[model samples]
Target: MSVVDPGSTRGRIVAAGIELLGTEGARALTHRRVDERAGLPQGSTSNHFRSRAALLGGVIDGLVAGELREAEAVHPATAEELVEQLAALVELLTGPMRVTTAARHVLFLEAAHDPALRDRLSRDRRAYVASVVAVLEQLDAADPPAAAEALMALCEGIILHRVARHDETDPRPAIAVAVRGALSAPGDG
Candidate 1:
């Protein structure tokens, strides 16, 4: 079970933090702001998080937990299914999940300067990669791990472009190509 339940105070604070980060950037993520955003009493956020690093850590944990939950729902039985799933993921990230995606990008920049944050994010990323690798293995990819990495990179790029650059171009073609390439024989490509 996840430590941060969506209905709990801690989860509310974390969700507020993500919203703040997504809408107003990292500078606006203060305990007072989080408390206000969460519609809690003053000091509530500080009471739970204790420090800026702890608050950020809570946000990261919350994001990872939610992402893992979504990933757990994906189980592609074939290469084409993988492509469709990945394409839909891109659409979801760039659409309804846009705010969360923006918050993630903010954390990514912050992680560059914080080794602890970077480590935490890296650990979560490895978990996601492992899940993708499992799907690739099921589809009989030539090199599941490498292919998973490639697909992850490609999806990251697509998400970044769509979110940051506001590029509305379709991602299905690229996702299909990458999925097909990953499933191809090692020497056939």
Candidate 2:
């Protein structure tokens, strides 16, 4: 099953790799598994990504790009607004995107041994943290950088907890509380 569109085929292969990584860990992220998961012919994955490293890099690229796009699409000017934004984000993390969350964690751990992947993950994490800082600044957070780091850590913890617990329902209430604590002001609402 060769795809006529090269770009779509690559995207599908990357998506398959992510799915496999999420479900079965790094050991299961073989070319054949990607092809089978993508519903493509045998060896198709190789034609697109020559090596496992390339495939893993593509998976990280796709994940970070999607997340960056999401961040750009949503902007909040208040702590309450940020919490409302987090409602949708919580739904995404605990719902259909749980596999993506799991795969991201897997790749993060793998990066410790792979410097190239570490650089990519580090760069992407910085971009994400910048977005969080922008939101924190808008809400007049006492310490935007620190607040952003804490919020990002909390968000990652949320994903880990949701993945391990296998609960798909929204975790907005917790997210709301964290945002409030991160951005709350004394003698002000």
Q: Which candidate gets the maximum TM-score versus the true structure? A: 1
lDDT value, residue 180 of candidate 1: 84
**Each model's TM-score?**
0.97, 0.85
Report the alpha-carbon TM-score of model 2 versus the true structure. Answer: 0.85
Off by over 4 Å in 1: none
Residue lDDT tens for model 1, 50-86? 9999999898888888777777667988777888888
RMSD of 2: 3.9
| Cα-lDDT of candidate 1 | 0.90
Q: Write the per-residue lDDT of candidate 2 for residues 1-189, one digit (tens) a residue.
A: 122232598888878888898889999999999999999999999998899888887888777776677766659877777877766775676677878878988998899998998988898799888988887887888878888887778777877777888765565677787887788764555
Worst 10 residues of 2 by lDDT: 1-10
Candidate maximizing lDDT:
1
User: Cα lDDT of all candidates, in order?
Assistant: 0.90, 0.80
